[model samples]
Each structure stands twice: as C-alpha cells, then as structure tokens.
Target: MILITGSTGFVGRAVVERLLAKDELQCVAVAVRRAGPKLSERVVKHVTGDLESSTDWSAALKGVSAVVHCAARVHVMEDTAANPLEAFRNVNVQGTLNLARQAAASGVQRFVFISSIKVNGEATQRGQSFMADDTPAPLDDYGVSKMEAEQGLRKVALQTGMEVVIIRPPLVYGLGVKANFAVMMHWLQRGVPLPLGSINNRRSLVSLDNLVDLLMMCLKHPAAANQTFLVSDGEDVSTTELLRRMGIALGHPARLVPLPASLLELAAAIVGKADVAQRLCGSLQVDIEKTRRLLGWTPPLTLDQGLKKAAEGL
Candidate 1:
C-alpha cells in the first residue's frame, strides 16, 4: 500500500491517478485535511485535521509501505504570515518529520519526498548548474524548510532504517498547473505580447508526468534508496524559448517584444517588482546526470513532446 499526501493538489493529483492506473500497486490511500468528493471514492481517504507537528497521522499510516509527500507551504508572491519561515517550518519541516517518524515506526519501507530546486539555491550563475551533492544554499523560507526536512528525514533513516529518496526538481508544469505557469499559459493562449523576449537565461523545468514517473520508479527501485536526485526534462531553455514554445502549444506564434535586460530590471525595480524580475531574468539549472547514472532512468517524454501534451490540453 502507498499513502500519498496532498492528493487533491496539482502534483499530488497526478501522482494519485498514476498510482491507481497501475494494477500492481494494489491499494492506495490519501492523507487530506479536507477530503474532497473526487478522491473519497477512489482511494482510502483520511480526513485528518490541518498538517502540523502535532497533527495525528496514526490513522493514515496503517499498512502503508511507502509515502509520497507532496504537501508543503508553497511559495507565494506576497507572504501573509507574520513570520514566513516559521510558517513554512510548521508544515514543511515539523509536520513532515512527524509523518516520517510515524511512517518509520509503522514499518514503512521507503519514502519519496517531492522537494524543490530552491533547496539548492534560487538561481545559478551562467554556466554553473546545481548538482545533487552541492552544498545547500537555500535562499527563501520554503527552500530552507525543505532543506531542514531533508536533513530530518536523513536522520530518521539513520535511526529507523527507513529508506528515504529525495527528488529536487525545478519548476513543474503540466495540465491543471497553477500559479506562474498557469498565468503564462493564460497569456500565451490569448496571444498576449510580452516584454520578455531578450532574456537568454537557461531554466530547467520538469513536466508533471516525468516527475510522477520517477516517483513511481522510486517506489520499488533498489538504487533509489537513501539518495537525493536532481531531475529535469534534460532540456534547458531560455525564457524566450519557453514563451515561444508555450505559444506553439496555444497554436499562436509568440508575440514577444524584446527589451534590454538591464532596462527591464531597472523598470521592475522602480515598480517594486525587482524580485519578480530577478526570477524571470535568472538561470536555475539542475544537473540530472547523477539521477540517470544511479537509477538508470530517463524522462519518458522529451521537452517538445511534453510541450505538445501541454498544448493539446490547453
């Protein structure tokens, strides 16, 4: 049996679907604070209260051999919490540890954690890609919390012999995706002319299906035990290229207006959006060779194919 958290979320929903489609997996369960109508009939749903350090998970961990933890305090453009780091730690670190410890005690064999690239750093310098073993340099509250969770999970593994597999992926995009990816898709569908043409920074992104496929493999693969893997579509693209491709998916040519990067940065700074501008103008690439070498795994879909899928859904 496999128990997945956040089954109603974007990535979590995809994970649940993939798991249910496979006959070998047998039984599937979901941990949710609010059980939705769509999931109750399909999986064993546990409507535990809010995710916190004190949240009881005894009812959810029963007979579960593995866990796919995808729940977290996601990144936000404007943080409402008085202490954003503490808010993130409440769910991402303490809550995550709570679940892992319980799972370990309950004889759960393996855990697959869905972490973010921010656990490495916000962005990389030109020609410098983040490797799995690089010293962690998390920049934001969410990243710091995830890094702490990784450390905590490793410690749990040491004490209880539970195999922990961590996957640090870049931006994940696909059907039913939200936030920045959704906004970009909405604009691309309307053929909106954007001012992000000249940016040439390479950003690595993982399609939702590719990441889910890796998780499915990790559930049973022996090589995935107790390892941190960096994964992507193995194709890095510039902001311009990404926009252009999304345009293709939307069946329209990208109407990008090129503006100098420096001037754009200056304009964003004047408008109190320097942080947003920095994300758009920066590079965040991951080197997934270790993942490939260790697990002998490859993304099932190429970037173009993934784009086509996204386009068709759009």
Candidate 2:
C-alpha cells in the first residue's frame, strides 16, 4: 500500500490519478484535509487535520508500505503571516519530520519528499546550472524550510533505516497548475503584450506528467533510495523563447516588446518586486544528468507536447 499526502494539490492530484491507473500497485491511499472528489473503494481516504508537528498520522500510516509526501507550505509573493519562516518550518520542516518518524515506526520502507529547487537558490550565475550536490543557498523562508526538511529526513533515515528519496524540482506546470504559470497562461490567453522579449534568461521547468512519472519510479526503484535528485524537462529556454512557445501553443501572437533587462529589473525593484523581475529576467537552470544516469529515466513528454497540453487545459 502507498500513502500519498496532499492528494488534493496540483501535483498531488496528478500523482493520485497516476497511482489509481496502476493495477500493479495493490492499494492507493490519499491523505486529504477535507471533502473532495469521490474515490474508488480501492483507495483509502484519511482526513489528516492541519499539517503540523503534532498532527497524528497513525491512521494514515497503517498498512502503508511507501509514502509520497507532497504537502508543504508553498511560497507566495506577498507573505502576510507573522514570522513567515516559523510558519513555514512549523509545517514544512517539523511536520514533515514528524510524519517521517511515524512512517518509519509504521514500517514504511520508503519516504518520497517533493521539494523545490529553490533550495539551490532563486537563480544561477551565467551559464551555470544547479546540481544535486550544490551547497544549499536557499533565499526565502520556504526554501529554507525545505532545506531543513531534507536534512531532517536524512537524519531520520539514518536513525530509523527508512529509505528517503528527495526530489527537488524546478517550476512545475501542467493542467491545474497555479501561481506564476497560471498567471502567464491567463495573460497569454488575453493576448497581453509582454515586456520579456529582450530579457534573454534561461529557466528550467518540469511538466506534471514527467514529474509524476519520476515520482512513481522513485516509489520502488532500489537506486532511488537515500538519493536526492534534481528534475526538469531536459530542456532549457529563455523568457522570450518560453513566451513565444506558449504564445504559439495558445495561438496568440508572441507580442513581445523589447526592453533592456536592466531597466525592467530597476522598474520592478522600484515597485517592490525585484524578485519577480529577477525570475523573469534571470537564469535558473538545473542539471538533470544525474537523475537520468541513476534512474535510467527520461521525461515522457517533450516541451512542445507539455506546453500544448497546458494551453488546452487553460
């Protein structure tokens, strides 16, 4: 039996749907927070209360052989909470450790954590791509929490012998994807002229299908045990190029206006969104060679295929 946390989330829904289609996997269980879509009898539904350090997961851990933990306090543009780092760590780090400890006690063999590439920092230097072993330089509270969670998971594995597989992914997009990707899609749909044409910046992203496929592989792959992986679509593109592609997918002209990247950054900084501008104009790439070599896996969908799917979804 496999227990999946955050089954109602964007990536989590895909993981659950993928697991449901696999007959070889005897049982699929979902840990949800509230009422949701109907589940087949084959899937056990456990209502886990608010994700916190003290939240009990014993019922969800029962009869579970493997765990796919997709729940986390994700990053947001404007954080309104008091002590955002504490809020993040309380749920993302301590809560995750608590779950892993209980899973280990329940005899769960493997624990797969879905983390973010922000653990490598927001962006990379020119011509550089983040590697799995790069010393973590997380910039924000969310990234720091994920980094701490990874370390804590490693410690738990060492103490309890529960195999821990960590996957750090770049921006993920697909059907039901939210945040920046959704905003970009909405803007494209409305045929908005974007000022990202001259901003030549490289960014790596993984599609939902490919990420879910990688997660399924890690669930039982012996080579995946106790390993950390950075995953992407194996394709890197600049902001202009990405907008052009998404525009093509949506049948919208890539109406991009040329503006100096520096000017754009300065303007965004003046508006209190230098970070968003950096994401738009900076380079953030990942090296997925290790993931490919170790897992002997390849992304099932190409960039265009994924983009087209996303467009259709929008």
Candidate 3:
C-alpha cells in the first residue's frame, strides 16, 4: 500500500494518475483536508486530515509500504500574513515532521519527499548550476522551511532505518498549471510586447509529466534509497526565448520590446517591483547528471513537447 499526502494537488494528482495507469501498484491511500470527489477503484482509502495539527494519521499510515509527501504552502500574491516565515514553518516544517515521525513509527519502508529547488536559492552567480551535494543556502522563508523539513526528515530516517528519497524540482509546469507561468502564457497568447527582450538570464524548468516519472522510479529503485536528487529537463532557456517559444506553441508571433534590462531593474526598484526584476532576470539552473547516472532515468518529454501540450490545453 502507498499513502500519498496532498494527492489532490497538481503534482500529486499526476502521480496518482501515473500509478493508476501502470496498474503495477495497489492499495492507494490519500490524505486530504476534506473529502472531495471519489477516485477510481485503485484508491483504497481517503483520510480527511490537516497537516498543521498532530492529527491521527496512524490509520492511514498503517500497512502502507511507501509514502510520498507533496503538501506545501506555496507563496502567492496578495498574501498579508504577519511574519510569513511563521506561517510557512507551521505547515511546511512542523507539519512535515509530524507526518514523517508518524510514518516512521508505523514502519513504513520508504518515504519520498517532494522538495523544491528553491532550497538552493533563486540564482547562482557566473552561470553556475546547483548540484545535489552542495550545502543548501536558501534565500526566502519558503526555501528555508523546505530545507528545515529535509533536515527533519533525514533525522527520522537515521533513527528509524526507513529509506528516504528527496527530489528537488525547479519551476514545474504542465497542463492546468497556475501562478506566474500561467500568466505568461496568457500574455503570449494576447501578443503583448513584454519589455524582457534584453534580459539574458537563463532558468531551468521541469514538466509535470517528467517529474511524475522520476518520482515513480524513486519509489522502488535501489540506488534511490537515502539519496538526494536534483532534477530538471536537462536544458536551460532564457526568459525572452521562453516567451518566444510559448508564442510559437500558441500559434502567435512574439511581441517583445528590446528595452535594456538595467532600465527595467531601475524602474522596478523605484516602484517597489524588485521581485519582478529578480524573477525575470534570475539565473537558476540545476545539474541532473547524477540523477541520470544513478537512477538510469531520463525525461520522457522535452521542453518543446511539454510547451506545445500546455498550449494545446489552453
């Protein structure tokens, strides 16, 4: 039996679908806040529980062979919580520990943690990419909380003899994806001339389908036990080129203004929009050679294929 937390979320749902399609695994369980629609016959049980509390999750943990934790409090616009770090810690850190401890106590064989590449921070200087063994130096509340959660999970694994596998993904996108990437897709479809042509920064991203494949491989692969993995699509794309490709996928020409990046940074700083500048001009990349050699895995879809699929759905 495999128990999956956050099974209703974007990534979690994809994992469940992939597991079901293969029909290799049986006895699926999900932990959710509230009981929603029913899943297929493959789902053996669903428990309505919140991760923030020390809820009774033993029943769900019982008889479970593996657990994949994908629940998290993602950052968003218009958030006004006082001490945002506290809010993220309450759920991402404490809540994660709670589940890991319970899973350990229940003698679960494997625990798969879905962590973000944000734990390594937004960008690396001189176009260097982050590797798996590098010491994590996160820059935000969200990244800090995830790093803390990884530490806590590692502690549990050490004491309980349970296998722990960590997967750090960068900017996952796919059909039904939301947030800033979705907004970019909307702008590309509208033929809006964005002033990001001058930004030559590169960023790495992962497709949801590709991420799901890696997760499944980690579940049973012997080399994945007690290993930390950094995964991406094995390619990098600049902000302007990314938008241009999206335009092509959407059957529209890119309308880009070749404004200097320095000027945009200056304007954003003056109007309290520095966050936008950081994201658009950020240089974040990941080295996935370890993942390829260790697990013998490769991304099933390329960036172009994934982008076209996303465009078709929109």
Candidate 4:
C-alpha cells in the first residue's frame, strides 16, 4: 500500500489521481485533515485533523510501503502570522518529522518529500543555476522551515534506516495552478498589456504532470533512495517569452510594451510591489542534470504542451 498526505491539495490531488490510474499499484491510502467526498471507492481515507508535531498516524501508516508527503504551509505573498517562521515550522518541519518518524517505525521503505527551490535562495545570477549539492541559502521563513525539515528528515533517515528522497522544483504550473501563475494567465487571457517585454532574465518551471512523474518514480527507484533531486521541464525562458507563449496558448497574443526594466522596477517599488516585480523580473534557474542522469528520467511534457494544458483549463 502507498500512503499520501495532503491528498486534497494541488500537487497531492494530482498524485493521488495518478496513483489510482495505475494498474500495478493497487492500494492507495490518503491522509486528509478532514473527511470529504470520497475521491474514489478504492481509496482508503484517514482523517488526521491538523498537521503538527502530535498528529497521530498509526492508523494511516498500516501496510503502507511508501509515502509521498505533499502537505506544507506553502509560501504566501503576505503571511499574517506574528511569528511566521514558527508558524511554518509547526507544519512544515514539526509536522513532517512527526509523520516521518512514525513511518520509519511502521517499516515504511521510502518517504518522498516535495520541497521547493526557495530552499536555495530566491534568485540566481545570470547564467548560473542551482544544483542539488549546492549549500542551502533559504531567504524567507518558508524556505528556512523547508530546509530545517530536510535536515530533520536526513537525521531520521540516518538513525532509522528509512530512505528519504527530496525533490526541489521551481515554479510548478498546470491546469489548476493558483497564485501568480494563474494571475499571469488571467492577464494574458484578458490581453492586458505587460511591461515585461524587455526583461531577459530566465526562469525554470516544471509542469504539474512532470513533477508528479518524478514523484512517482522516486517511490521505488533504487537510485532515488536518500537522494536530493531538482526537477524542471528542461527548458528556461524569460518572463517576456513566457508571457508571449502563454498568450499564444490562450489564443490571445501578448500585448507587450518595450518598457525599460529599471523603470518597471521603480514603478513597482513605488507601489510596494517590489517583491512581486522581483519574481517577475529576476532569474531563478535549476539544473536537473542530476535528476536525469541518476533516475534516467525525462519530463514527459514539453513547455508548450504544459502551457497548452494550463490554458485549456482557464
């Protein structure tokens, strides 16, 4: 049996659906915060209230051979919590370790963690990309929490002998994508003129399908045991090109104005949208050579194919 957490979330839902579709993998169990409508008749559901250090998992871990942990206090634009780091740690770190420790005790073989590229800092210099072995330089509370979780998981693996796989992916987008990706799609669909035409910085992105594929592979691949991997679509594009491609995918060509990058940055700062502008204008790339070479894996969907799927959903 395979166990999955965060079965109702964007990534976790996709993982559960994909696992159910497979003929070889029969038993699929999901650990959700609350009981909702059944995802499928075959799925076993366990209601584990809120993710924290004390959540019980004995009932859910029964007969489970592997675990895909997708639940997290994901990064947000403006966190209202007074102690953001502590809040993130409560879920991302403490909760994760709590489950992992139980999984190890229950004799689970593999634990796959869905991490983020934010663990390697927000941006990279032009022509440089983050590698799996690079020293972690998490910039924000969320990233720090993830990094800490990774560390704790590593220690658990060393002490308990349960293999842990970590995969850090940059900007995932697909059919049900939310946040900035969705906003960008909305802008393109409305033919809103954007001032990102002159931004030449490159960013790496992975489609939801591609990420799920990697996650599935890690479940049993011998090479994936106790390994850290970075995943992407194996393509990098500038913000302008991305907007343009998305516009085409949406059947509305992007209306881009050739505004100077500096001026755009200035305007964004004036409006207190500097962080937003940085994400749009900065370069953040990941090298997935380790992923490809170690797992002999390739992203199934190309950039255009992923964009088309996302566009169709809108």
Q: State TM-scores per candidate.
A: 0.97, 0.98, 0.96, 0.99
Cα lDDT of model 2 overall? 0.92
Candidate 4 runs further than 4 Å off = none
Residue-pair clashes per candidate, as listed?
0, 0, 0, 0
lDDT of 3 by residue, 52-169 (tens): 8476788888789899999888766556889889998998999988888888889899999999898888787637899998899898888999999999899999999999999999
C-alpha lDDT values of all predictions:
0.90, 0.92, 0.87, 0.94
In model 1, which runs have C-alpha deviations exceeding 4 angstroms?
38-42
Give candidate 1's error at residue 104 in angstroms: 0.5
lDDT tens digits, residue span 1-314, model 4: 99999999999999999999999977699999987897787799999989999999999999999999999998998989999999999999999999999999999999999998999999998789999999999999999999999999999999999999999999999989998899989988998898888998999999999999999999989999999999999999999999999998999999999898788889999999998888888999999999999999999999999999999889
Name the lDDT value of residue 188 in candidate 1: 83
Best model number under TM-score = 4
Q: Give the poorly placed runs of model 3, Cα more than 4 Å off.
A: none
TM-score winner between candidates 1 and 2: 2
Cα shift from native, residue 164, model 1 (Å)? 0.5
Best by lDDT: 4
